[model samples]
Target: MVAADSTMRMEPAWRVLGCRGCGSAIVECALVLAKIPYEREEADYATKEGRDRLVQLNPLAQVPTVILPDGTVMTESAALVLYIGGVAPELGLVPDVRDPLRREFLRWLMFLVAAVYPTFTYGDEPAKWTHDGEEELRRTTDEHRKSLWRLVEGAVRGPWFLGETPSALDLYVSVMTRWRPRREWFAQNCPRLYKIALAVDADPRLAGVWADNFPA
Candidate 1:
């Protein structure tokens, strides 16, 4: 998804505590690309001590906890994107809270989180998807993800989801969908979304995160 040698730079005062290759990590990826001043602290989420401290910030104990210098702490990657974008609305990286697209954005964004991602990222087991077998569940998840990607692929009637400018949603989708190169699996089936990923990846604004622990 990025040039081989690309990198993300951070400034002091912001700390992102999480893994390097998780979805939260991808949000950190976008934050760095936006040139937001911050640093990452990879925490052992599986440990009780780490889990306890993380829950203090986010009751759900989600990864990617952001602690600001002013003692403000927030979790949930999408909400974090909104918070950071709230600080720099001029960047147009986020839609307005009042803007209808903001709702549309979150609706689709969380769908990616609640439905699309977990389905694809979880264990390949029958129990996970209520299917009779692991192979069946895997097939079902893959097909569902493919359909979701296609839905998003068509949602863009304009250059971006909103029509004129690229958004946090754009950044979110790009990083989330960037997986191992599978020309037919993604490039061919999800052409429009794939094309958008390439376009966003090419922007200097986003090039900041091309390096680091992003997926290949």
Candidate 2:
């Protein structure tokens, strides 16, 4: 019943632990849009203790793990966006349940999570997948990821993913373009999506968060 209580602002604080450049940046961006009070703890997934700490909170040992004020833990970037969007409807990050674009919102959000994010999770460091042909695998995955971005570029409707207003979908894509082969490649291959990314990057609501998460 998150949507039912969308207008209510709870007093509890929230803390998310993850690397700034990772998907956790999406969660941080959503929190800023929601105008919710929260803090971030930078965790280095490279170290043993760092990995162990994340595993302790989230069995998956993933970044973007949120510690709710009530001692409850939350995971997954998409779910966090939905939850925070519900908690703060004034921001328009989450569409109304009855709105037709709601379906589109959910679809693109899941698409980013299921398809786009995995590229970095597996492609950026293919050695984690197998030692025999890591180089080839990385190259293949990088190309596949670029192709996926092109598909998304064609799907965008302009100004934002759902059109006119900003949403969690745009923010997700924005942070993602900053990774891997980098934004230059994306700009050339997926011009439309690259524009959406730039718009999200320059959004007034997200301006501060973007600067903090991605410094020049």
Candidate 3:
């Protein structure tokens, strides 16, 4: 139940319920990059208390569950990214509807959330999904994830996932590369994406968000 700065005279327009070091950082980064007004609630799904709180907002109890200013509940990082982009198209975190790269943007965005993210969902806690061969499941998923990263590496256009322009895809690459398989593996095998991750990490707009979600 950690609150945002109470000293502010006005309430933040958005309430983000997310755990630090989790996928929620994507939304947090977006908000910060867009200069949107928001407050974050630490909803650590690993603990019963955190799960209970998130379950109230989202049945799946997922991190990055967002309560919109209108009180609408939003989940799924991809959807949230799109929504944030819609709200702040000037930031260029999402390609314009008319941009040629918009198609590729949408394609890989779905690829990440639909294809790559599930590997972590299932692999991170094999016991939750299966009663047997947890080790095998983790290993299999890790290999599969590596293969997926290779696919992404091939698609990357350089400087960012979508070429010279940055998008939410860059944010995904930035944060996710820090997860399983680790930065060392990404640096060796996915150099293009590794460079993008490093760029995103260095963005001064997200310095505070990155610091809080991924400490020194």
Top-TM-score structure, candidate number: 3
Q: How do the residues 1-216 of candidate 3 rate in per-residue lDDT, one tens digit apiece?
A: 223443443544788898888999998989887777788888899999999999999999998899988789999999999989998999998999999999999999999999999999999999998898899999999999999999999999998888888889999998999999999999999999999999999998788888778888
| Candidate 2 error regions (>4 Å) | 1-12
Going through the candidates in order, what is the number of backbone clashes in each?
A: 0, 0, 0
Please provide, for model 1 over 1-216, each residue's C-alpha lDDT reduced to its tens digit, 9 standing for 90 to 100: 232223433323577777555566556656665556666666646678777878878776667788876778877777787777877787777777777777777777777677766664553345645655777777777677777777777776457766677777777667666642333466787776776677777776544455555546
What are the candidates' C-alpha RMSDs? 5.4, 4.3, 2.5
* Whole-model Cα lDDT of every candidate shown, in order: 0.66, 0.81, 0.90
Better of 1 and 3 by TM-score: 3
TM-score of each: 0.74, 0.90, 0.94
Candidate 1 has its poorest 10 consecutive residues by lDDT at: 1-10
Regions more than 4 Å wrong, model 1: 1-12, 44-61, 97-100, 124-136, 180-184
lDDT of 2 by residue, 90-149 (tens): 788988898888998998888889988787788766888989999888888888887887
Residue 102 accuracy (lDDT) in model 3: 95
Model 2 residue 20 CA deviation in Å: 1.9
Better of 1 and 3 by lDDT: 3
Model 2, residue 141: distance off in Å is 1.2
